[model samples]
Every structure is written in structure tokens, then in C-alpha cells.
Target: MKMIRNVAVGISGGVDSAVTALLLKNKGFNVTGVFMKNWDIRDETGNCTVEKDYEDARWICDKLKIPLIQLDFVKEYWNEVFSDLLEKYQTGYTPNPDILCNKNIKFNKFFDVARNRFQADAIATGHYANTSFGPYLENFKENTNVHLLQAYDSNKDQTFFLNQIPQQTLRRCMFPLGNYLKNHVKTIAKEASLHKIAQKKESMGICFVGKREFQDFISEYIDDKPGEYVDLDSGLSIGKHNGIHKLTIGQRCRIGGCENAYYVFSKDQKTNTIIAVDSGIHPALYTDFLITQDVHWISEEPHELRHSGVLSCDFRFQHRNPLITCNVYKISDNRLFIRLSVPLRAITKGQYAVLYSGEECLGGSIISYPGPSFFALNQQNSIIETRCCDLIALTSGVQM
Candidate 1:
């Protein structure tokens, strides 16, 4: 064990963090709470969210009898995270803000601030994740390769959003909530006379969106670049769309004049077009392969991958999805081609493809594109347009 005495915890006014700070204090560690001010905008309630959250954070600190510090990173957040997010959305990429937030704000900036400014022996967060170094960083050594592991509570594991965090940062980080379930954390808070905190509604969706639809929130930044929704099989115009940024792959598109509900299959930036297919697990939505770029490795390249230039592992792009068998081939230093054991539905580009070996999160990268769709695979045997039109007609109850 590193014998960490002074620990700085990132408190977000949530039940998880409250329990985390409580656990650290009970363990006899010198604890300080840090309130990070990343976004300064007001919510739909006409009050800034951080303001309300900060008040709650203050309450937790007072109850725990720990000193609290406030750090502002509004500028750093804008330049490092939000600007890149906006750029990606405008460029037809469905970027995840949570991933970017962990990579830039929480891990990068917070790590530096806690270690350098506050002189924390170890930094802690309420994230539902674990590490090879254990909670107190007992197993960490000089240049030790730390593996980000899944939480005991699978439903609450946050490793997906944290895959992009730097290795050095993970080495010194502690997740007190990792070994416990979400409900248990709430119970702990309640037992500590924090009933109000335990029962508070969970913060949902993008933190900055603040009670607005994603479409409405994003529209304020990007100009309306008009586009059309085209039927991928029929090559017929389904309807006009105000902007491609309004939707992403697998979303049930709300375009009118189409009897059958449609879902996006692809967004063509150059043509300003959205390729779509009728809903109901449409064959066009499934793919057997994906191309990824800018891969990040937690413990450098794995032996199997580096020695043979390929490795077999489990892959999951979305956090909620279960892991699937896959073979990842190195295309270059930071690029990879992944072959899935089974065709999966809605493998979205711009989303991450996280690789795993059992419980350890190896790393991940942004998906560049996917291989031939199920619809494409069947094209050689049948007339794609006619079959697709028939399927649409059948689903929508239209006469064939």
C-alpha cells in the first residue's frame, strides 16, 4: 500500500460521491472535497446547475467535517472538451461528451490540480470502477501498468466513459464506490443522516444540455445546414431534414410524410444526406466489422497484440451492451480493424469500440466506419430496392 494519508475527492453533490467521501473519512484518511466548476451555464430553472450542486457539496463537506475547495476550469473545459465536441457534431460524427469529459476535464485537469496544487497523496472519485492497484493504490509501482476493471455492480460500472483516461492518472486514482452496488451506496448515505442526498434524483444525460432536447441545445451553436433523408434501398426521397446533426445512427428519426417509422443508417457529410431505413431491426442496421482510429492502450500494447499484430478479445461499443467476441488487427500504431464473431446491429461510427480481456478494460478508439451491412450482403442475391420496399410496405401495412 502507498499509505495515502491526504486524499482529495471530487464531489459532485450526488449520493455516490457523498458515500465515497464518508468511506474515506471513516478509513482515517485526511480528506478534502473539491467542487469542480466545469460548466457555468444556467439551467432551465433560471439558476446555474453548478450553483445548486455546489451548495449540496458544501452540505456534504460540513457533515463530513472536511474542508472543501473550489476549482474553476470553465475555460479549459471549453477549449479542450466542448469545442472539440461541437466540431465533431458539425462534421457528422456522433461524439460522446462523457468520454471526452473523463479524458480532458476529470482525469487530465483534475489529476494535475489535485497532485500539484492540493498536494493530494491520491485522488478519488465516485465513479463505479476499480483498478489493478486496488482502492488504496497498494499494488502500484514505478511505471506499473494499471488495468481499469469493471465495478462489482455491472449495472453501474462506468469503465466505458473512463477508458480514455491516461494510465498515469489511473495509477493514482481511487474509486471507493467500485466494490459496492448503487443501492448500498444510497443506504450508507441514508444511515449517515443524508436522507435528502440519498433520495435525490440522478443527474441524467449530458451535463451541459440542462433540461433541453439535444436538437434544441445543439442548434444554438451550429447553423442549420439543410439535408434530405433518403431511403437507402429505394433511392427515393423520404423527407427533408433541417440538419444532420439533429440525429445519429440507430435513432428513430422523426421525419414526417413517411408512414413507416425510419431510423438513420448513415450520415453523409459531403452530400448533406441521411441514409435511412424503415424501423424494426432493419437488416441495413447490422454490420460484421468496424474500423477504428486513434486507439489508446492502458498498459501499452498487449503481448498477443504486439507480438502477432493481432489479438482476440471481447468488444463493446455502448456501455449498456454486453461484450462480444472479436478479433482486433493492428492497422498501424493507433488504428485497428475489428472483426466481430456475429453481426451486430447499429454499430455506429464516431462511437468508441472498447476492447476487454475478461474484466480488464484494455483500451478503445473511435470507430471510423463499419463493414458491409446485412442489406449490402444480400444485394448480390436479390434486388435490394424491391425487397426493402416490400419490407417497408409490410411493416407499414401498405398494399404491395
Candidate 2:
């Protein structure tokens, strides 16, 4: 008799995860439901919905006839994810905590616990992404390995969040909902009589913070420091802001009595100023090049990037705008200089610039700073020096 594979599914008490568990159970595998409690802190109202989620998870596990394993990683999440997130915001850059959560908590911590404790062959999630074991076309010398791919449901594809996940961790993972559309998954849940799970509304906002306002939730951790709002074009003081930490690049600023809505162009942390522009189409809001640090390739660095020094990229998640074609120049072992074919708006610092080749997710890096267009910088005879520990300083009158 053949032995069945024992698979662990990360259940988040949602329809996606519940259906993922059900699918695996019917597929003849020994399935186990694991509920990861990464955040347990309550908001100002003294409410935390984790207990309700736990109950929902328990109900699903009972229906599926599978044992549910509960694991708490609140301390690890606070140290690894939340600390870095706060630091990024403090430095005047908006960071994506969802990507960090996937890399640090879900794929790393939870992955380790499931593999070591449960001795499971593979772990599965409700994420809308697919993985395949195949010989990489770029590196023909290596053996077949796991590679992350976009799901069939383009609208719901989550390869963006999973981009930073290591290839080794991906090898031991399964995405049961990868090939199915969101509606189809709901249809399956309805047919299975999991009506409550099917009708459960999807949670939004930050992963741990639930539906609370972002600024309000963040203010709890960091106190508001008032600052000046200045016009970037005229370099004139316009108004006052409660906190620079509450603002982000490209966000609209509502200066009282100004009919024209001004957008945030940049923030000067040293001077405690928020630079605003009259129009969203301001030249400072767009950039044709950017510098990135800590670049991570999914399998291996593409041969073209190393040799030809160019590749196609998608710098943001679910960006429906035309794809960005850019040239990749290596600044160092851990840094890259990307020159885009066209100017991209709101090229904010601290956001992940994810790269891709067709449908394959090639991973990404944190955008350190937006660089001047090669043409413009060359015309000005500018020289950029990396003097302040990975900080690029332009010498020819170009200021970010």
C-alpha cells in the first residue's frame, strides 16, 4: 500500500484557506490545519478579532475532520516585522509590511514550525500563486528546482507578496487555489455546505491591523511630531502638518483654502519638512531611474542582466499601467541601478521594486532612492557618489 503525504495547510479562518483545506482533504492527503496567531494586540477600543478567527478556524477544521494546530508568533512578529516597519516609516519612507510578513513570518517562522514539528511533506496556503519544479532556462547548468509563477486568476494573483520568499522554502509549499478563480473557490465552498465560510468578507488594510485607519494605528506606536509643509517648486512655506511620519510620497495634502490639491513630493527628515507640489503631474513625482539595495532573485540572477544588462520589470504590486522596460546596471554585489524606459510616477523610497520575466516572479529589492534620468544626469555632467554608507549623493545640482 502506498503511503499518503501528510500536508499542513495554513488556515487564516477565511474562505480561501478553508477551501484550501477542503481541497487537500478530498485529494487523499493527510491534511492538518495550522492557525498562525502572529498578532494578538487589541486596538484602542480594547478589541481584537483573533479569537473569533480562531473559532472560525476550529469550525472549519471540525468540518474537514482534521486536527488544528495553533501557533503563536506574536513576539517574533513584533521583533522581526513590526520593528523594521516602524523604522522605515520613521525614516520618511513607506514600507510594505505585507511583503515583510510573508517573508519573515509566514514562509520563514511558520514554515519551520510546520516542517520540523509536524514532519509534513509539504505545506500549503490559500495564496493565489503557483509553483513548479523545472530546469531554469537562464541557468541551464543547475538541476530542476522550484520557481514561483503567477496564478491563473490575474486579478487575484499574489506573487507580489511571495516574491521575497526563498526558492528552497517554496519547494516545500503548495498552493491549492493557484489554478482556481476566486469565484470558483466560492462555488466549491457553497457546494460543500460551507456557506458561512463562503460568505465571510475578505479582510483588508494591513495584515495584523485589520480594518483600522493606517495613520491611527501607526500613531499608537509612534508619537506625532508636527512639521512644516513647503512647496517644492517655489521653496516657500505653505502650511503645517501634524507629522511627517503620517504622510507618504504621492499622497494628496489638503492645505486649507487651497482649491488646488497638492501632492506630496518628498520629505526632508533633517529639516522636518513635507514638500508638496501643486499638481500630481509634477516632474519631481516621476523618475526614470532608481537605486535599489538587497536585491533578491528567485532562482538565480538572469543571464541577460549580467551580460546584456537589461530586463523587463514590474515595480509595484498589481500595477495595471504599461510594463516597465529597464536596463539593469550592477552598482555592487547587493545594489543595482535600474534605468527605466519611461518615467514612473510615485517612485517612492522603501517600496519593493519587484522584477519579472514574462509570468515568472524573479524577486525584488528595496528601492533606496530615485535616481535622475541617465539622459538628464549625463546632460548636467553629474557624478553620483555612494559616500554615506549606500547613500547616493548627486554632485551636479540634482536634489531628491
Candidate 3:
């Protein structure tokens, strides 16, 4: 029934959160600024940007005349987010830390703190997505009917990064910046005399881990043993590598002494070998379907992507959210048989396979590929030789 009055807006010392706090304050909600100290403790070689971020958040809060609170979540960040990431990588799957951080920390931990600790009515953030809590809340004491909608600015939309969060958590969350474009937010910040935030560079990469080489950052937690780089087709050694963990699928750079253009398509931990394939001017790097595990459906009961025998999906986060039919039969209790309507290239593992229908994000899971991997089938390769689509369908089924 009634709209939320007291709100705790998570301020990250960035333009987006700054603008969100300003917008909420203007709307007459009792707003308090909180800077989440998720990764306060860093490794010996690593550093936490907490001091700088806290200072910036404090500065903005003073200017806006809102009470600022710093909540330290170092243990929770290590246990829930980073520890899970290390486990995923150890098992050879790529995991998006930001997604987990938002789900477990922002919506879950941060909301719990605001409700139980600070006694705030609701929690808000700078995420570029709108929220919808249905009118039938009187029937349910705890809200369980929230829907996440796309932001007005498609370019800055962060919905894909948030598909893993539970539906109920989406209820108590507010995204004030969702209705405005980045430029409009900048203008608002400037008019509000928050010009210091206007000139700040946008933060990139994982929030907990700063902008360093991924392998280098992870080495602190996980140790690696070096392996060999081999030609995928030939199985002949081309060069020695520091470790398989140092590389990833579809990577083309930093492997020593390749004759021509070569790309890493897969890695074999059993043989300690990195499979390198020939990637010409334009490599055939596409695929159809993905064997996925660890599914998280926000709204409805989880089901296989197939409804009428085809798996409908969105394989990547940015640009061209392709709508394709799919068929997902169960392979095990967890893993599923993902067969797409058409071929997709570079369907990377450890990447999110977010399924959608029109504007609704149904669910998402991790991407998986079979062994002895090669270039993904495409039209160009079909004219030269065997169609990738056919080869992929035939060979992938055999591997499965």
C-alpha cells in the first residue's frame, strides 16, 4: 500500500550513486547515504580503494547534507563473493563477481543491514534498472512480487548484470537513475553543484578487485602450475605456458612463438595442454547451444529454455540481444542439454547465458562447451568446407 518513505541509498563515490541520492532527496524521501565497505581488507600486494571512496562519499554527503554511514562487509565479501569466484575458476568456469556481489551483498546483505540495523524503510542504488512491486502485497506479509525492468538508457542498462538476484530482493530496491540517460544525470549533478563527481572517471572492472591483470589478481588466492600450449588439430607442442589458469578460451594474445594468427579455444587440465587453433583474418568463433549449470530464475519456477522444442536465449550482455529458440533436456541433476536455434560464436564458458523473451529476462546460467573445441560454425566456413553448424551439432552431441 503506501509508498516507501525512509530510504538508504548506497553511495559508491561515483556520479551514478551521487545523482541517485540527489534525485531521491529531491523527491522528499528520508534519505541516508551509505558507502558499502565490501572489500576493506586486501592482500599484501593488493590494495583497497576504501579510503578514497569513503572520503569521496563523505564529501558528497556533506554537500547534500545527508547522514553518511560506512558499513564494513569484508568477511561477507570474502565468504560469499570472492571465495565462490575462486571455486568457479578452479573448476575451469568463468564467473562474474559483480553479479554475485550485487545479489549477495548489495540486495541481500545491504538490505538486511538497512532494515534490521538502520531501521530504514527501503534501500536504493545507482543501478540502471527500474523496479516494480505488484499491488497485491496485502496478501503477502513479506514482499515477494518485485519485477526488474530495463532502464531508459539502453547504453547504460545494467539489468543483465543483475539477473542472478532473487525476485523478492528486487522489491525493496530503488534505481532512481534508471529513468534518465547518463548525460541527463551529469547535468543534474552539475546543477546540484556536485561538479567534482562530474569530472570523475567511471569505475570499471570488478568492484572488489581493482583494474589489474585478472590472472595476477587471482594468484593471491589460487596457485597455478604451468602447462604446455599445443595445436588443437595437431596435438603438437608449440610452446610452454606459465599455467593454464593464466589463459582463457577465445584468447589470442600473449602466447609465445606462433607462426601465424592462432587463438586458444580450450584447455585440457588432464593433459596439462592449452589447445590453440588457427584464427585467420576472421576466425570461426561461434556456437549453437550451451550446456549450462547453476541456473537462477528470478520470477517464475525454473524450467528448461525449451517450450516448443527450441531454446530461446540471450548469450551475451552487450549489443544485439539475439532472440533464438532453444531445447534444454536434462543431462544430470544440475547440468542441462542446451541446443540453440542457430549457431553462436565464441560462446565462452564462465560467462552468463541470460535467457529472455522480448523485454522480460526469464533466467540465466553459466556457459559450457565440450572438449576438443574448434572454430564455431558460420556461413563463411560453410562455403570453404563443412558447415560449422552441422559439424558443431554432430560433434557436440558426440562429446555430450
Candidate 4:
């Protein structure tokens, strides 16, 4: 197929993107390298890493012989992704920043600026996911009707992070590295006489605003206060906690003092209290239904099956959860009901409950709160204890 010549590829000063730009240039396309400065985060000790990132990106662009452009997006990052994350944490729920970052920065901000300012025909990246144009184009606007598919390298497939983008955006985006596995990418980088690029380590872990503990980084924007950690079974106060923002549901470490290992059950923001219980086997951990809001349906409405009475569905990224049947009791512009086939454990609030129908990902939203248990919330305590599983549900009542 003939290729679109003018392209802007996002370079994060990483091997993945470095290879992407080289591949595009190899195909005789006019490629301009763009280094996106999304956050001003430093290393763990609070030193700026921006210069290192810029230098690395510049080095790779020079080797690839492409014009390197820098786009500072710190303001957009705070407004679109990080600010919402802090609000969610303030309410005592875990927020996935990577998911939001992929949506707002890499795709939205990059495409918007690259196309409008640079007059580029297409924006490209090193994402290990596939994209293809749709069959029809009469009704399609620019970059519309695109399809996102799993990358050839399944282990590194990042389709989960790119789900929020609409079909059109995918159409204009390029993934030159989508067809190859990681090892092959390194091999190609080496064969291209870029051995050092091949030897570079991959970037991992949370994208922080500065070099600090996650709690400390978040604490700068959010307040910290003392709270109580109570036993799930006994309802007795076991210890004092620094703040509700410091912990997440289903986490097993750092709380200090418990007979058996305890997992976070619930956090009460109003009272400033945490409840945890022994990570015991309980059918209650497995829930049959989940409540959700802000539903973004990916395909045609789910067709309900008659044979199976249970309507369980996955509530995590990339079908990470088991295949469970779920019934959609109700759905509106923003709210909905999901009845699961079996009880599953640790249904967290504030996290997405992305439903699936076989290979296709149906759209989902933050679990605002868990539905009432078929049985009591807990057997050990007179009052119900919140577990990590209830994260999605409790996040519903959390104020935005």
C-alpha cells in the first residue's frame, strides 16, 4: 500500500518510540519527531529529569535524521488527567493515571497540536497496538471510522490504555511497530546500526510529577490527616493511619500489625477511618452484580443471553478478570446495573469495569459503589466492612 508521507511521531526518549520513528523514515515517509513533555516529574529524590529526557530524545532524532520538536503539555496534564486523579484519591479510591494519560496526552493532545500547528497529515507512536481504516468513508470526517486491534506482541499489547479514543483518532494514528514483538524490535534496532538503542532499558512504573513517594507526590495537591484502621471482623481499632489517601483497597502491605495478613476492605472519608480484614476465603468476596456510572458503550448494545441467568462481566483493563456473565438490569446516559454470573473478590471503586463480549471490549465506567450483598456484607463484624472489591462501588458516592 502507498503510505501517507507527512507524519509526526511522538518520541518519549524511549526505545519503543525511537524505533517507531526510524521505521517510518525507512519507509520514505516525511517524519518529524515530537517529544511530548506531559509532566515535570523528577526522580525519587526530587531532581528534574526533563533535561535527560529531552537530551535522549534529541540524540535518537539526530541518529534517525528527523526534525525533533518539543511540545510542553504540563497545563493540559494537570487539567485533564492529574487533577481528576487527585480528587478521586481524596475520596479514598485508586485512580489509574496511565489509562488517563494515554487518552488525554498521547492521543488527544499530540493529535490536536501536531495536526493544527505543524500541518501534519498524521500522528504516529510506538504503541504496541494495531490500527486500521474502516470500510466506509462517505459519512466519515477526517480521521474517523478507525479500528484498534491487538498488537502482534500480545504480551506488550497496550489496547487497554487506548480504549478511550474514538474510532476516527485511530484512523489518523500510525503504529509502525505494532506488527513486531519486543525481541524483534530490538533486533531491528540493532540491524539498523543502532546497537545502543537496542541496549537501552525500557521505561516502567508510575508517571510522577516529581521524584517522591506516590503518597508524597499526591499529598502536595491533597491534604493529609490522621485516621483509624479498624479490624474487619472484630470492629476494633487496631492502629492509626496517616491519611485515607495513603492506602487503597485490596492492598496487603504497610498497614502494620495483624495476626494474619489483612487486606483493605473500605475507607470512610467522612469519618476518616479504614477497615481491613484477614485475607480469608469468603464467597462474599465474589459478587454477582456491580453498579457503574459514566458508561461508554463500545459496540452495539449487548445482546442478553437466555440460557445463563448470571450476568457477570470483567471490570478491569484488557480482560484481566475472568470471563464472567453479567446482566445489564438498567442503563441510562451515565448510570447502569450489572448482575454477575458468580461472586468475584475485590471489586474496587474508582477503577473501570470494562465489560466484554468475547474478544470485543464493551465500554464501562468507574464503579461508584457495590450493590447490596445477597447475603450480609460480612459475617465477622456486625457492621459491613469494605473490601478492595468494593472500590468500584464506593467510588460512586465519592464526590468528583
Quick one: RMSD of model 2? Answer: 7.1
lDDT of 4 by residue, 1-400 (tens): 3245688999888788888988888877898999988778666666666777788899999888889999999999989998889888888777778778877888788898988999887888888876544211112246234455567877887766665665545667788777889999898888887787778777666656543567776667777898888876688988887888877766663556556776677789999998877764533344566687876554334445223423445545223454556666555657767766667676767877776554445556768776454335444344334453366467777632
TM-score of 3: 0.83
Model 3 residue 384 CA deviation (Å) reads 19
User: What Cα-based lDDT does every candidate model obtain?
Assistant: 0.90, 0.81, 0.73, 0.71
Please name the candidate that would achieve the greatest lDDT relative to the true structure. 1
Give the Å shift of residue 111 in candidate 1: 0.7
C-alpha TM-scores of all predictions:
0.93, 0.88, 0.83, 0.82
lDDT of 1 by residue, 268-287 (tens): 99999999999759989999
> Model 3, range 1-400, lDDT digits (tens) per residue?
6556888999999999998999888888899999999877654565668888899999999999999999988899889988898887776666788888988998899989998888887788898877554211212235556556677888887888888887766766778887789999999999999999988899888765676777787787778777787775576888877666666666774666676767767767787777777773334355555687787777863443334433444445333464566656656555666766666555667877776655556657776653222344433455656556567768788532
Model 1 TM-score on a 0 to 1 scale = 0.93
Which regions in candidate 3 have their CA more than 4 angstroms from the true location? 41-47, 134-144, 280-284, 302-336, 369-400
Q: Where is the poorest 10-residue window by lDDT in model 3?
A: 133-142
Please give me the total number of clashing residue pairs in predicted model 4: 33
What would you estimate as the lDDT of candidate 2?
0.81
Deviation (Å) of 369 in candidate 3: 4.1
Error of 2 at 305 (Å): 2.2
Q: Ranking under lDDT, best-scoring first?
A: 1, 2, 3, 4
Tell me the deviation in Å of residue 80 in model 1: 1.1
Q: Can you give the lDDT of residue 345 in candidate 3?
A: 54
Judged by whole-model lDDT over C-alpha atoms, candidate 4 comes out at 0.71
- lDDT (Cα, tens digit) per residue for candidate 2, span 1-400: 2232788899999999999999888887889999999888876678788888999999999988999999999999899999999998999988888898999989998889888999876788999988764211122222346778888988888888887998767877888888899999999999998999999999886866667777787898889888888986678888988777888888998689776889898889998899898988876777788899999988888887777776656555233444566777888877988887788888888888887777888888998988563334553553443343235335544554
Q: Kindly give the stretch of ten consecutive residues in candidate 2 with the minimal lDDT sum.
A: 134-143
